[model samples]
Target: MTLKLAIQSIGVVYGDLGTSPLYVMSGIFPDGIKHEDDILGALSLIFYSIVLIGLIKYVFIVLSANDNGDGGTFALYSLICRYAKASLTPNQQAEDKEVSNYRLEVPSRRLRWASAMKSLLENSKAAKYLLLVVTMLGTAMVIGDGILTPCISVLSAVGGIKKAARSLGDDQIMWISVVILIFLFQVQRFGTHKVGYSFAPILSLWFLNIALIGIYNFVKYDSSVIKAVNPLYIVQYFMKNKKEAWISLGGVILCLTGSEALFADLGHFNILSIRLSSCLVVFPSIILTYFGQAAYLRKHAEDVASTFYSSIPKTVYWPTFVIAVMAAIIASQAMISATFAIVKQSLALGCFPTVKVVHTSRKHEGQIYIPEVNTLLMLACVGVTLGFKTTLKLGNAYGIAVIFVFNVTSTFLVIVMVMIWKTNILLIILYVLTIGLTEFMFLSSVLYKFLEGGYVPLVFTAMMVTIMFIWNYGYRKKYEYELENKVSREALVTIMSNTNIHRVPGVALFYTELVHGISPMFTQYVTNVSSLHSIVVFVSIKSLPISKVPLEERFIFRQVEPEESGLYQCVVRYGYRDAKMERQFFEKVLIDRLKDHIQNDVAPATDKQGEPSDHGIAKVNEESVQKVIGVLDEAIKSGGIMYLMGEREVIASSGSGLAKRFVINCLFNWLKRCVRQQEEVFNIPHKRLLKVGITYEV
Candidate 1:
């Protein structure tokens, strides 16, 4: 984490928080400007919210609850999944334990309560699904954040135009906002890397200007506003305003909207860089800016509607407005990119539909572009902007998503602290009391506005959660069917030994979901055709819980029987972050490994005529088993490789209830169709692919 990297991080990570002062004051005082005491109280709430939630909880605590270097809702889930045996992915091989992030360091003497919690999660199907739903809810809220952050930030910034020219109407402001949003989303295809360097300097200047202006305002308009820093002011605020103060926390929540970005973007920047940037640059600047705005509002209370724009010293208004707009775009960019990353991770873990993920940076796997998601997000952001048409209204919808995700992250962190970190129980209670209570206050406030645009994110969240549920439920049912119905290894070996069945020419790679044993699809194929390939390879591609698998340990090869069977099984494992290899890369690696295995030791030589002799075919050192590698290599070179995959139509069983039938037959089937084809996902060419369709009942 160099000084340069920290500065760059400020550009990317702090955009939302940096731009909050633009709308936070007006949002809190939407009815009208308040008295001097109320302004001080609002300032107090905003300041402490930043200190408590932003700087302390997220920056210091929740950021540490990441898997390896990754953070976010799924990252926390992945960490817990690795520690406990609660992952929905059932095929856990010994090799998977070797991944870098698989931390198996639980206390040898497990606590009874911790062990019970783990057992309940792992043993009960309903508990496990509930956990998945909880995680998906958090992820969906983040997606909601991606939609709302841009609408509020950009609209608020453009609304400043009205401050300059009082004649500008809402329609003109909306058109300007829509144009800016169009431009912002239009450039997404080029990726953030191309324009990343410029972000640091622009954000740095934005912070410096805000801080300088804040200092100027503090001196010019009642430096006494500094007294609002006391916690007693927060008490005074609630006492003075009662229920209104509690409701106003929804507006105060805006200050901490991007606080999670400090943690979620941890993979892009190290903790030290994020921490230093937050403390040295982001935090001080934002607090002073808020205080400055509060001071300006204290005297010119009538200007509370646009304190951020009006209070800007006339000397630098134009530069500040331009910089604020750029900063808002940068903030929206960070949130959008984070949404893509989360969706990609979800796809790898079988929780999302298989959308096309385009790697934007050759050097960074995390830098990606998803056209489907991008277009959807653009449409949603535009809808929110045009529909709400005001920053205050958008702010009402915005805080709910952020607050919900914050509460989810806090709840999961408590479990991690107790079960994984095994922190002192007393300290854990305090965390729940302090952090949990603060978040609940904000959440309650936001939910109070459910009918007033707050329902917007709730609708989005519900839609996303339904998608995830259908996907995961469908995935689990299919896996269970495969596991229960797969042919035993002995039965598969016997089928291979039946010499009466004709052996065809060329190599056949039967793609299976199972890591071991013959897939039901293979049985279906052989039962129908009554024949086998000259060389049959059962290839299973498994996604592990870790982020990346080391290249040397990716594939595990095993012979299906004694040397002459002409059958083998290859298990190729990938971590969630690993790129799907191209067909050429897959074939090259598989063939090289098979060739090495053939040449390594004593094996028999069997000729095309089935005659066993020392010189009959390419030999290792034994008779009757030879030239297998030669056959496979020649077949691959001649484009004679064929891929056999099972296309399953998941249907409702006769005994399934109506709800289950509807979910499986309706929602899951639709989602399955939207997923990428097996051939494309695994980089297998469709020209040489054969599909075997089966109707699977759950």
Candidate 2:
């Protein structure tokens, strides 16, 4: 099973990194190779970058910081939230601690530094906001990668056509690449289970083919290219061509384009499988292929524009070209799938709007397809391809997104070492000096080309960050309103006991985000109609930070006041990766759990007037249990069930500043109107659903 997973991960996890050889050499020397020794210098930089950054920083260190089995920026934030009071949501309760996987490792009291850091984060509002902004920035960059990766990979591979048919124009290659990208995204609805099985064999064969071709080129042209492994060449190359070499770092960084996917897709596969695939298959194949490209460039520098295809032996060029195109599609597919996963995670954590999420595989919870996100990605990718019309410009855009995510991950990793792992301060500083300095240099190089094409990602990221911030700000304010104005138990009792109020013969499920107390929407309903249902259940759906909550621990029940009041509270907990339950299945589970709770916890305590009669306590408990169950069954059979939901309109207060007003009244309201409604999300029937409208000034 482990071996199977390792092989499978190669297709999904390493496709982007593997197919990078198609463009890396060309990107590094877009104008043509100026000096033969420059090839060796660039090769040395690639070798050490893969080793120190990709292999050491991510595969070895960062992968270990995964929250349970989930990875990505949000997962890191969740890990910190669980350890300290870092979450902005105030609905967390003591009952949440009873969950089986809600594990926390508290720092020792003697570790005052760790304690102080946790204290600062928990007590300071500015610190919390800063942390959230950083996380959103990272998430936005990953989405940027999703858009740019497909453009560059497909364009670079399709450019190989010019080597075969010298008469073919650049426009023809662009159209071909666009068509291939469309087809690739069109098939994503089939899910990774089907796509991955087929892709694994293709990617595996691609690696073997490239490695063999690389060895052939290395031996035939110049085996001495192996001498480029020495770090001295990196220094000499820099001294000879300082500014040009620095600018080339933007292109060199493309070698590590898909490195984040190795961590982002961790939830779909295990750590051991990712590590095994990277170390044994991906790492060696990439090194050999790059070395071979360097050797070829040393001899025929004019072929630098189309290095990978130009260097291929004549007899095998067609076969390799076919594989390269397929490999490029596979790489794009991996990034597309990863984008879906991260967006879904963001939605679960309340940072993104609600979109339709389709579970692509019944067996794998992490495999999902969002039609909305897929359509957007497809359009963006095609536009980027046609707009750029060259790999050089797309590479400039891609480098910024990739390196920004790297820097964010590095910042979070240092926090993890200090707070979670308790590593020595000196070792953490050492990590900063080595890995941090390298990424900072890459970031600088990419920023230098901001006007050339790099502004694409920055502009996209700013837009995303703004949307996320506005949504989160409005969400938090609405929750605060609900918490502040919630109807108390005594107030509900008074309303229920009013002489004018009448009991309707149905079961009512009031859906709310509040975990405790009755929603103000309910108060408005009863006050207007002067009636209450025979039985009322306040249903609060909460999403945790983990992947999947255990089935046995999904529902938590509590009585509102007393069993005879016919009011109950149900907190349905789901982890970020868990699928939402369907209407019928969810109703059945809720009713069954409610019945069980009535029999076990509420029956015996119902008769509190005096001691039991000669019939004894068991007899009294049995009678009470039967009576309550009989009432519940009768209500379900005769009156049916209705779902009551709150529809809120949020507006800014009069005293708010211009920025807050814009975020709340304009941007947030527009987003709320655009996203899916509560009734649509839960799939409630129109006849059976009742919506209560309320206005909130935040």
Candidate 3:
């Protein structure tokens, strides 16, 4: 990455880290800082936590665990799934491995544990669900972070209004916050790309402004606060205040809130950019700002609740407040975009409902806008701001979600390091000791505040977990049902050949989840109509785990037996990161491939007497194929074409347990009702689409 991009990355990737100093102190000491030791200890914890977790674990380690270029919880899962063959998606094809990054090599004896882990995941269905839960927990927390980060960051920034004008009330701050938030979310459709360039200048000014303010405060009061850099102060603080010190970890964790975003957004920017911008600009700036806040707090012990504003010089308070709000908005923007990206990944992985995903920038596929999700997020953000009403309460809620997400990311990291990277077991142990222990301390502390605002994220996490689990479970059951009940290829061919069945004139494209044989929906449709189209095509659209499929390998065609019957099956494969093409483009590609198959693979039509019939057809050649395509195009245009899809409702069997029945008959079905039908999901024209309703009890 160029230095320019690295600078730009600071605005996009490090906004949360850049603005963290606004509330980290208050989050650490909600009731105000009383003792000098507490200031030293909190600063010590913040400094070390940033170094250990933010720099070592994420900047250096977890960043490398990205799948192709994409990063996030699901991206890690995607990489592991590729190597282990432990994917839940049933249509995983050998062509998926053709991607450059999906290459596999023989495992050495050192990978025994890795192999065993893969075996455990592959051999157990329970393990898959467990993996899904863990992954979605991280995902859900990210979504929750999308909600909480803005509430706290913007609220804290706007709280400065009270500091500047002590006459202002809480209601005023909140109303301003709500308006800003509404505007923030409302503009997401335009995307960051349009205004992305402006972010760097604002962030740079914000960083420069904070660092200057921090240095001035550090020199003006308690310059010796720099001594907090020693590790001994951390021990002294914990040793002195015991339980209070332990609980304080939840607050201290606020410093590292945006570190996960570094890894989550690895796809959008290069690691070099992330490292350079974070280490050079963001890290030092936040460290200085935190230390400066601690220094000022050590002198004016009552300023903890408003340290950020009070520490600002009178001359620059207005500019500082403006910059703070801008920074907060940028930080919220990063998390919100990350949520959209994660949801898109989940949809591709079949863990989410098929929501409309609009790519905001054609140049960058990752720059997407989900209107439904954005609106929901906006409402939730507004609710959170209205509910918490203060930075401290939101901080309590924020720490839990972020810390637990860190725990999830760390757990997945350990697995990837062991199984994929094949790191030394001893190093892994040290990694777990340092990173895992810190995250656990924070997680435990945050959990202790369960009755306090921490319950909010837990509630959100539970809701998301239920949604993801049901969607995945329901889809898995549907897939298994299809596997069990799909009509056999030979049987389908026999049915097609049966002269008793009436043949209709038209081209019908049957869409199905199943790749090899006819879907049970097709069986039902055929049984009801007791008729077949003149040209029947079975089309299956499959999503691979990779980021992008090669153009040449996007479409695969197979001719069903007795080609004279005009039966064919084709699989159109797209990677999870691939852009969904227009319906017309898809139709053209499918028809062209079908034409190619007919000219090259399928034999010419034959008469009942076993003689080749010309039927006014041209000979087989490159030029003749075009003439043939024109003839076929005329037939397609005149005969008319229809896209056939199934609308399936999964019902619970009579013997199913109460819990299973609720999941299938209630939760899953409710979600199914909410999701768009396949034709709508694929952007197929409604006028040319036919839906076949089918009920399956599993």
Candidate 4:
């Protein structure tokens, strides 16, 4: 991508983070910048906080720890896990398995290991949960932003002409915002492809305008505002009154809420683009604008936040409105895109349940993920807009969740870096201290918004935590059930050979959970005589990335043998992003095998549906057909089993009979309990858990 595209991407994804100044600068002096000292103190807090947290903590320091040239809490976690897992594997395998969770301690610091062990595990989980929740809240903020962006951007732009020369009522702003928002929402269904390219440049120009505005301020103020760069000034303001300054940080720190978005959304934009733009373009603009506002506020305390727009010459109002609209639209889209990214990554990591994902681009597979998420986010945004009524009110409630995640990420990234990579001790220590100080400062600022509007982030965080706990709990519960009952491949084969059962001569499809061991999903109760010469395929399916398997390797199959019952078993696999079952199967080149085993051969080439013109076993060629049956016979006579496994081999079987036990125990119990559950409800045995949201069946 060109620098223009990169800048556009930053303007889009980093918009929320980049445009923190809209509310941030004014937030500091919300009660009006009554004195020169107050204005300068708040300005300095904004400056150094940006330098320490935005520039150093994120752009310079944490961003440097980019894993595989990727950034984001999710990306960092993946790289760190890869790094930590390898080192911990041997130690965990050799040392005590008492510590079920892996620990990240300094290799030589034996003394610190015991003390840090609890902290490491605690921090890792805390960071994971916090990021997950904050990401969700950020997603929610986008919803707030989406509606506001269209409404305010369009309205504010149009609102200027009428308000300046004629009537200045709220109706003009309200009506225009509504009409444009509706138009944008309606066209969203048509998708963004047509104008997406055009939108990119517009977005780049959007940021450039802000950069230019900041440049103008810098040209006017020069280095005079540079004196407002001390941490203690922020401290002294609090020391003087304690109450007012404490609240002031909340507004001041708002400038930096979206700052963390730069890192959280690393997967969307590359490093150089984000770093360069944020420093030279996004950073300076925000700083200069803040200083300009500080200068304006120092000179005009009574007109600080309110009617502050009046301070700018009337000649520039329309341009300001145009820029605001562009920035808002870009910001809104960025948040939506980030929400999409987070969901995709969540599905990949197995932290979220299966959802519909759509790939909109052939150029970049990671370019798109889910439509359902988009629709949901859109709904949330529209709802929040109608509910919150204004962007300023939403801002008061926006940051805590994002900040909570930011601080936690800082803490966890260091631990992750320490565990997974080799870096100088001095740098590591500096990271811990710097990120820590910056995080605490931001958190301190967000507190002021609590009663006024900070409760919004809390609500968002709680919802995220609730969903996270639910997903993780359900996944683990499912895992625990599989762990308790699933059996092994060898045992399955052995059982097939030892039994003298006789029955049908067809394919025996055994439904098993796409999990390790024998899944309890299939029927386990086997008390009657069954057919012989039947190949029992123990099928296991998987969504990729969660398991160790790469998606390309996700669709795997295993063959079962010619046992005493003449049965052959098989298994299948799927990645989360995989296409239809039939398509992926043939694409993987298993057509000949299916033709031979099933004894069916079609025309010269099979169609997309795997349909042969005359569908029967008799269509197979003679020589090739014999080999397929022969292979099956030999497998039956010798091994009596073939193993089916995913990259994770979700179903890990040891011996054949071992699985039979699990089938009999767990699956059977679930069936019986399910039946009883239904019987109690309707006075009849029709319950099967309703099969709601079930990904697979045996």
Compose the digit string of candidate 4's lDDT tens values, residues 581-645.
33234323433344344454212334678764443433454445565566555544554332222
For model 3 the local lDDT of residue 548 reads 74
Q: Least lDDT summed over 10 consecutive residues: which range in candidate 1? A: 616-625
lDDT tens readout by residue for model 2, 1-698:
87888998988888889989988887788778888999999999999999999999999998999988889888888787776677787878787778888885655543665677788888998888888899999999999998998888899888998987989887888999899889988888888534765689999999998998889989999999999889999999999999999999998999998999889888878899999999998889988999999988889999887888988999999999999888888888888888888898888778888788888776777678988899999999999888898898888999999999999999988887777777778888999999999999999999999998999999999999988888888988988888888998789778767889888888999999987677788888887778778888999999886767887789988878745778888999998878988789999999999888888774443346655444566687888888888988988887889888888888888899998899898889999998888888788999998888898887
What overall lDDT, based on C-alpha atoms, would model 3 receive against the true structure? 0.84
Cα lDDT of model 1 by residue, 420-442, tens digit: 87777788899889889999999
Q: Flag the better candidate by TM-score, 2 or 3.
A: 2
Weakest lDDT window of 10 consecutive positions for candidate 3: 615-624
List clashing residue pairs in candidate 3. none
Output the worst ten-in-a-row residue range by lDDT, candidate 4: 86-95
Give the root-mean-square deviation of each candidate in angstroms: 4.4, 2.6, 4.2, 10.7
Query: After superposing candidate 2, which stretches have Cα over 4 Å from the reference?
Result: 104-110, 603-615
For this target, which candidate reaches the highest TM-score against the unseen true structure?
Answer: 2
lDDT of each: 0.83, 0.87, 0.84, 0.51
Q: Per-prediction TM-score, please?
A: 0.93, 0.96, 0.94, 0.70
